[model samples]
Target chain A: MIEIQTDPLLYRVQKPEVRERFEALKQRPVVLSVQNLYKTFESQTGTVTALKDVSFDVYRREFMCVIGPSGCGKSTLIRILAGLESSSDGKVLLDGNPVTGPGPDRGMVFQSYTLFPWLTVKQNVMFGPRMSGKRGTSAESEARQWIDLVGLSKFENSYPHQLSGGMKQRVAIARALANRPRILLMDEPFGALDAQTRCQMQSYLLQIWRNLDITILFITHDLDEAAFLADRILVLKANPGEVNEIIEVPVPRPRSAAQFITPEFIATKYRIDQLIHPDQGSPEDALPFPRMTPQGDDVE
Target chain B: MLTMFSFSLPLLAWCAVSYLPFLWHPDVELQISADREGVTTVYTPGDRVSEEFFPEFEAAVRTQNEEVSPFMSLDKPVEAGSESSVRRSNKKVLRHLAPLLVSNGWLTEEQTKDDAAIYVAWKEIATGARLPEQPALTEENLEIVRKNWALMSRYSDSYNADNFVSRPLLSLVPQGRPANPDYLPAPHRVLISGFKEFTKPAEAERPSMWQRVGHSMRIVFGGFLLAALVGVPIGVICGTYSFFSKLIEPFTDFFRYMPAPTFSTLLVVIFLANDAPKMALVFIGTIFQLILVVANTTRRLELPLLEAAQTLGANQAQLLTRVVIPGILPNLYNDLRILLGWAWTWLVIAELVGVKSGLTEFIETQGRWRNFDSVYPVIILIGLIGFFTDQILSFIRGFIFPWTSEGPAITSTPVAKVLLFVPRWFKSAVDERIPYQPESTSPNKA
Candidate 1:
């Protein structure tokens, strides 16, 4: 009785050979694994549980998106993976090593523009390499390559204050990538941008991910963004927030924003939506009331 | 434009009211002449008749001149112009002279006459005649007589000129020429030390005003540098760590309240009686405030930036040098500039400790002698230097920290350029210590 064999929809959407390849890839190696993670915040008021019993695994070079409604601890989960926040219970392992605190191995992009204002665009990209003890002509050339990769070659000498919102984010991405970390953690990187800039950034991010071959864990509230960008989506439930389900999108790779209108994309979004709000009707017949997904004993 | 006009209206009114009446007056020129050996004399062009016959009146009127006057008899009026007119003018001088002489017991009231009696009394007094109850003629008493005579001379001259009330304000700005040298020597006359014969030898012994100002600057710079060296580090430590902040807080707070100059006794004991004590006074005056100001400024540095640097693999020292120090520099520079001005105030207090050759010391000695001509310029010179120092510091701040909007400036000087490159050199030094990992050529390179 194979558990994966019971899921017929997944089999129908993905050819058997492709499904076999995915199952093989899943077993290849676990780059990052979280086990029963819990985070509690205690203040003058009573303690509020921000995350509870959260568990997931990310494969090498995979694009994973975590989506949840507001106050569902989506950000907390990503922050924990970034080693910026520690989990109260259980542990996180990055490539077989226990996660302790922020280190050079994991690069993070915050929702706010965190580019060093005192540094120029080139200097900001070079910061990681320089701080880690890389100097001279070679390190500079490497920094320039990353800057050029982010399409900010002409703005190498410009300070962060001189750059626009989107440009500043690009520099931040370049800065993080310059260190060449194994995994990239983005916490609502495009959340502050306008709708048009957000769409453009989403496309640029996808292009960079494809080119870099680096694993990514992106957190966003937008379902469409998750459906368009994720290889697998982690859905979380609020009020002592915990992972509801982890659903894989069986869509073809090398996709663009145009694929968002396709049937497969819509179906994957619908499935995730149902998993999030099982009691509510389909997204088209969306109820005015708040959606609350039923809790399930779904752990992997 | 209207706001500017409103702001300037009061200043314009003050200038107009202060000087317009003086501008309207004509023939306000009054030549004050003094015979080199005898008393200084002043002669107004409007009173030529009196000027010709009454050289004694000329000598008496110019109050500031301290030269001893020769005893001249009124019976023999100077042989100038007509004899009858000279005698007539002699009677006018006699009336003014009579009251002063009678008060000093030089002449008895019984001897007073309507016309020629004063001339007869003057002759008698000049020949050493003394009253029955007259006090002994000592030097002090004779000095008092000379001052009284000068006072009467001024009263008679002004009373005779008649235009005293409407005298031009421009001529009264205290230049040497238009004023009576014996009276209030004009400001310029007091200033002209080049005529060294007139100036006291003691006044000649001091260094020039500019040299004294330079001494003040050297003391201020020494104190300011020491304060910065000691204070900035303490501030940085207190700001970055909570333990140090709590530990240093009470002392810094208490010391700021206690006046700095009050430490002069302790400073003299510690630094000894020399330049050290004076500079120590300035150092103590500014260091405590500088520490607190810089500490407060350092505490305000954004925490996220520090976290960001920490995640970037920066150690504690690197984080301070690269992020925290640079982050607080612009504001710290502003704090130092303001504190430097405060240090200048301490210069007056500091120079009082032991050194008596600084600008403030020069001011003190000159003030005692009332040579305000040199004093006022020294004060203005201090102000100018302070203003210019502030300007130059701000200018350099901009050149060094161009990233900040406050100092949105760039370096052109070779020294400033070298200083700006120091961080890069420091970064390279930091880089050299960390082991380098050869990066794999990623297939992702496009």
Candidate 2:
């Protein structure tokens, strides 16, 4: 077996105090635990394994980000944790109980704008509470608190169609959070936003995470976003996807856009890029297209 | 302005065809008429003949009148054996002047049937006491009236049926004006006839126009409401679950193609001869299409809405009632509106099947008699009913589904306010029930 520290791609730079921070994080009780999870889909070409021997734990109040290249089964893994899809083998436990199906204990936010169009922002937020048998004024008051938490109190009465893309997602986040779940499962929740809006959302999410006691398992394919938000990053590989490595994000928190170029943040993002793109060479050499442009040094 | 023009254009066309006498009056409507000696067909005033035939008719009557005059001067007393026939023929001559007298406002409609009153009117006209103004009597017709009255006064000064003149009166020459066919009456004639038909009291067994209108509305609304009641739930179920869709849609798809009218005889047999069968046909005509349309609309509900509800910890029942129902409501409402129009297309056929009833029945009867002036009003009324109902429903849709962008923005009109009042009140009532909490106050500031 190759020595991990000796491998150039596996080298990680970290702050001197990062080891103590990691030890403290590990002491927190596990809120969600996955054991030997496997998922297979029966396509026309017989059974195809989507995820194989996937296992990870999300500690209480911890912010974990799962990053991978395309087709890495990151979405499938998050869906399984959300109880939207079932694993072919192994188990998912929330706290101490086995997760059989979607419940109020696990809240979910999708990449798409999933706010109920017919309902107002407040009504959309109140939906989970109402479904669990909270009705009338009490549900409305609780929903208002969440709307307040997401900083969308002004738009509480406006319908989803009346709101902008960022505002709609904010309502969606408010709706998911209103359930008061132990863990929040997000499947690339900011994937569809513009870059500026996405950056703003990342900061907003970090602020919300700091204030609430809720744990989050966020899935994304962006290395910078993983480094910026996650206390620890879980990297996944494709073709019968499996866990490649779990990196402790050594960038000190109270993070801002200013920290994006810090030595610790850059080291963390670079390590993720290497793992997700292991064979990155000159892609132009593989293309057989004939070049029709005039030969000139000015093109570069 | 355009809506007004759309309606007025048709009205203008109709008026042009009706009032323009020189345009296409192929036949002549008689103002004065006479009978032939050997012919069984008696032509009366207001009867129409081809313009070519009018002159021949006048010549025949004039030739017969010459023969009658020479015979009357002979003063041959009528035989007792032929007295009744002679009186009958003279009475017919007297009635010819009745149409002219009625138009001059000298006789009432009831008096035209009274031979005694007609006898008196003849004396008045011959004596120049009652002069016909609009269609003044021709010199020739006036001479024939005076000669006939001279002979009639010899029997009695006033009309007495027993002593009525027992000799044939001289027939007046036929006179007429150019006119359209009997089926294409002038606009004023149609308006007058329509007014009479509407205001006419229910005579013995016949119903009034209002009753017919009410009955027609009942058939359409009853059948449509029943179909909606039954079809909406089934459609929603089929749309919500694939198992239900596979089980129900295939059969419904097959059933819709069989044609609802084909089952008319079967419906009549099962429901018997009444409104039941007619309504059943409408129900059948509407329900199958409604199911398919509503199912398709429900299926079109965004999948993300359903998945979102599922993740919100909603159970199966809550998902259906809260999410699926509300999510598909606006579209389903639109589908039902369109399907209601589909239901109306079956009305004419449905009403004809067994024990014909409603406006369709009236249209069929009047149409058969070729009284198109009377038929026009009923047909127009049905069209107006459908048009106005659709327009009103479309307007109300804006108030009902304010969330949908297809509708106009909600306004503060009184009707809209009244429509929106109940839901708003209910929401506010729920809000009021919460206990006051000072710490949670001004949540927006958070």
Best by lDDT: 2
The root-mean-square deviation over C-alpha atoms between each candidate and the true structure, in angstroms, is: 14.1, 6.4
lDDT of 2 by residue, B214-270 (tens): 888888889999999999999999998999999999999999898888999999999
In order, what fnat does every candidate score? Answer: 0.33, 0.51
TM-score of the A chain in candidate 1: the value is: 0.87
Stretches > 4 Å off in candidate 2? A1-11, A44-49, A67-73, A221-224, A235-248, A261-300, B20-190, B418-446
Residue A148 local lDDT, model 2: 80
lDDT measured at residue B278 in model 1 versus the true structure, 0 to 100: 85
Q: Write the per-residue lDDT of candidate 1 for residues A1-300, one digit (tens) a residue.
A: 222222324414776765775786697578889989999999789999999999999998889999887899988888788776788898899998998988777888888877777888988888888888888867877787788778998999888877888988888888888887778888998889998988888888898998886889999988888988988889999878889988777677787877887666777777777667768743445546545655785544
Residue B308 alpha-carbon offset, candidate 2, angstroms: 1.4
Task: DockQ each candidate and list the results.
Answer: 0.23, 0.30
Docking class of 2: acceptable
DockQ of 2: 0.30
